[model samples]
Target: MKQPNIILIMTDQLRGDCLGYAGHPDVKTPYLDTLASKGVCFDRAYSACPSCIAARAALHTGMEQSHHGRLGYEDNVPWNYANTMAGELSKAGYYTQCVGKMHVHPLRNYLGFHNVDLHDGYLHAARYGSVPYRESQFVADDYFYWLKQELGVTADVTDTGIDCNSYLARPWMHEEKYHPTNWVTDRSLDFLRRRDPNRPFFLMASYLRPHPPFDAPQYYFDLYKDKPLREPFVGSWETEEYLRKDGRIFDSKTGPIDKELARQAMIGYYACITHLDHQIGRLIMALIEQEVYDDSVILFTSDHGEELCDHHMFRKSRPYEGSCHIPFLIAAGKNVLPDLKSSSTCHAVVELRDVMPTLLSIAGAQIPDSVDGSCLLPLTADPSASVRPWLHGEHSYGEFSNHWIVTETDKYIWHSATGQEQYFDLKEDPHELCDRIDDPDRQNRIHELRGHLIDCLKDRTEGMSDGSRLIPGRPYPVTLPHATAR
Candidate 1:
């Protein structure tokens, strides 16, 4: 059998439930909905360390947080993984290319792609005055450099005065063709036109939207701006500590206090998603036009989800579903795997780590010994199959740092800084509106999940847990000692 082409479509800060197929009432993702209809959607996919850098580390290296050594969000750290997904596939004779958002240190570190057309959208660290000219986005990022060339040196992503992390949003200031989202697709289509046709190709078309600077083209904003959207999920468990920062604070991680502002934010966010969905449609069309659509295996997912005012929170790096749960689906070309299931949903717990092993399995390539993730292809054939009983996830956010355990039906969260605990029966309360942490009826289940978290942390250098119980208030570092050594 010929090796099938692999296409990975990645979006930043996209929620698992924000697509039309996911039954989201407000968001309209016809293209993604069609893809999900022709694929198996992993209903319970999550990011163990729900932040861009950490979740991406897991995806690239096929290892969980502890193994990959990135536990939370931190910039400027070197990515030194020895066996990356692209690198391993390259070794297996695939011509790999990534068109957007590597998000790794030194800006141009390709990890393992044969070539990279980099654009890690508006990274503040790379734009710092202390950063060398060679490493700064002006020279290091392909999209930024091209934007300047097309519009002159003074043009910048910040020209609209919207901070990258701000909840405020508006339409793009430049031509729609020059938008970073379009630039990624434009280059990706160019790659298909110029790729080595004899070898099976691995193309990662990553987009940086539905994240921030929520500047989708005006048409997308018009799609949902006046529509009645669902209000943010504000849980009963929310406390003053979590809601203290009002939404007016530009980049407030908490409340928008103003309901109208929240609605506008949603408009911008959903608009970006629909715009991204159309771009994905373009890529699929290109594949068919290139006559390789039936010989490609495509996977779609995100590094992490935006909080989007869920529980009064607005960014990622949390243990909550709004931040951790992410969309995951795999659609294999009919010619490549005719028996693969379509229009199915899997309840089994999965994560970014599983992407590597799954794709490698599809490509008939060797999955490295260091990979801790399982191939999910088998689950597509049987949606009820079990990959694992439960998943453990964590993130190191200052006072809100947390560890969590999630199964298909429920979730348990523990705040490391304050020793606060919250539990939710996800089956009954999918939005996580009510906290069952103190409910006597659910104590046994919560205790079991807590034990899972303790076991996960017992061997850590920070001593976050003993074999028996969790020990809170331990110093948390973004990259563990093992990663630093690398």
Candidate 2:
């Protein structure tokens, strides 16, 4: 049996319900929908840490947050994992390449990819005062360097007057072809043209869209601007105090209070997604053009999801569906695996950590003992097969820091700071509109879920659990002790 080429398509902050195949009403994702039709969509996939840095650590290392040591979002922490997805694949004789958004520390740390064409979008840490010229994004980022060459040195993505994390948006200041999303695809297509034909390749086309700066091509914005979009889901658990942030703030995590601005933000976000979808379409076509379409295994997912004003939240790092839930699908070419199901849906609980083992499994590589994730290829054939009973996720955001347990049908959240609890019947209220924490009928089930969380935290250094019950008000660190030791 020959090894198959693996293409991992990753998007930053893309919501699980924002795709056409996922039954989203407003977002148009024709290309992604087509891809999903030929793949198995994991309906319950989530990002355990629900932020860029931590989520990516899980993806690369194939370890849960506790093992990878990123409990939350923190930048500049060195990625020192001995075994990574790309590293293992390279060992298995695969030509590993990543095109965009490594999001790792040092800006240029390849994290074991044979080569990386880097572009981590508008990192504030890299652009801060007193930073060395070598570490600056302008010098470290390939796409930014190219943009300068094409449009002059002063040109930048920030020229649109939008903060990278801001919900404020507009079309690209330059032509569509120069957009970062296009550049990722452009470089990926170029890689296909020059890749060694004798060996199976592993390519990660990571896009930094639908995260923020909400800039998309005018055509995509136009597609959603006139459409009647749905309002953000506001749950009964929300309070005025929690939702009191001034939405006028450029990067308000509480989102825009102004309905019009919120609407525009949605337009920009959906447009970015559609624009990204088209770029993905281009790569799919290129795969076919290169005659590898029938021998490739393509998996698409996001690091985390955007809140997009859900529960009055705009950014990630929350334990809500809009923050942790992500789109996951694996489309294998007919020649790649025998009798693999297509146009299927899997209900098993899965996470970003699962990507490493799954891809290595597809490539016939030895699964490292250090990997905590399981192979997902089995679920592609048997959608009902169990991978795990439940998943535990957490983040260390200030005040709103929380731990959560999610299964196929429900979710239980515990805010570590205040010890506030929220439970939702995901099957009944997919939008998480009602909080069922105190409901008499649901307490037993909630207790069981809480026990799962307790077990997950009992052995941790944070003292979040004392073996029996969760301990609130415990000091939380973004990176755990293991990460610090590294």
Candidate 3:
């Protein structure tokens, strides 16, 4: 069998439920729908960690947070531990390239690809702050430079999304402006057209839109104006902290979501997704035009999911399905693998870490045992391919990290800072509308899942660092200011 080339497509802050094929009536993801008709779609794909840097570090490096150590927004992933997909492919005599937002810190540094044109999925306030590279090497932030040169746009421009609206809300809703997703796609297409085809190649195209600033081109925004956006999941305001954030996103009008604002935000998100879909379509066409489509495996996913006001939250930072779930579809070389569901959804709980091994497996490459996730090739080919029943997600909020484990029967979440515990019977209450932690009727099931979660933590987490207050699987930096001296 000829080794298949890989082209991975990643969109920032996209959700598993947003695509039209995923039962989202309003969002028009035609290309994705067509691809799904011929490929496999993992309906319950989840992030290992909900935050961008940490989650993506795990995905790219094929290691847990403790192993790679990118635990927060600004934290860096250790590039020395092992080979990433790019590194592995490069060693196997394939030319690997990256051309979009990969939140793994040091831009092209931790990324082991041969060719890199890096960008962040969203505008990082840290871009102008500190980094290993000089200004010229900061490609994601170059949007500002490019926008100024091309559109003469400035930072002082007041976005209509935030400024003044009574019926509508969300800080950046009215502020229409140039966004990073659009630019990432443009640059990626440029790379695709100009790519050298001498060596079988692997290129990652990452998008930054639908993540924040909720900005989009006028045509995209207009395209989704009348689409029926998915409604907020029930019990969205159950958590006091969540309620507080909701107030802030709507009150000050600097950031947040209201009912209508959230609706329009969905349209903006759909617009960005449609924009991304078009770019993806163009890339697929480029691959066909270049005649590389026959021997290549195309994988589409995202770092994690956007809250999209799913649970009265504007962004992802929790263990809920909305925050952790994502869209993962793979087309195995000119449609070798027959479509399993014809726009189907897999119920298996898959972690982002699994992506590395699966991609390597399909490429006929060996994945190091040190990497934790199992190869998902079998699952893709046969819908009955089984994986872990539980998908765990961990995240740090303001220096505090919370751990959660989701199983087929129940869900368990634990916040280390306050020792807050939450339990939900997912089989019964799919939306997590009620907390069943204290429900004695299901205490036995909760305890069983709790033990399972502890076992999972034991198996995946490395060990506790008494000084850092972190367990094995999750890691935190000692100097993040929130880290007080012992």
List the candidates' TM-scores in order. 0.98, 0.98, 0.83
Tens digit of per-residue lDDT, candidate 2, span 1-486:
899999999999999999999999999999999999999999999999999999999999999998989988777777888899999999999999999999998889988899999999999988888778988998999999999999999999999999988988788878999999999999999999999999999999999998889999999999999999999999888865645655666547788887788899999999999999999999999999889999999999999999998888888999999999999999988798775789989999999999999999998999999999999988998988979999999999988899999999999999999999999999999999999999999999999999999999999889999999999999999987677444
> Model 3: per-residue lDDT, tens digit, 1-486?
566678888877788888878887678888888888867788767886776776776777676655555545554433444667678777777777787666543444635688766655333344446654543333435555565666555442124444211223232332233555555667767776776756667878877656665556677877868656557775832654645554454442122444566677677677777877876787777778877777778888988787666556556766777777789887755544443344455667777788788878766788987677888777775776678877666676643456777865668877655566789877788767888888889888766666665664564333433332334434434223311110
Local error of candidate 1 at residue 57 (angstroms): 0.2
What candidate 1 gets wrong by more than 4 Å, as runs, is: 240-246
Ranking by lDDT: 2, 1, 3
Question: What TM-score does candidate 2 get on C-alpha atoms?
Answer: 0.98
Model 2 regions more than 4 Å off: 484-486
The worst-scoring run of ten residues by lDDT in candidate 3 lies at 477-486
Which pairs, if any, clash in model 1? 247-255, 247-256
lDDT tens string, model 1, 269-335?
9999999999999999999888999999999999999989888888799888889999999998789
Clashes of each: 2, 0, 15
Evaluate model 1: give its TM-score.
0.98
lDDT of each: 0.90, 0.93, 0.65
Candidate 1 positional error at 175, Å: 1.2
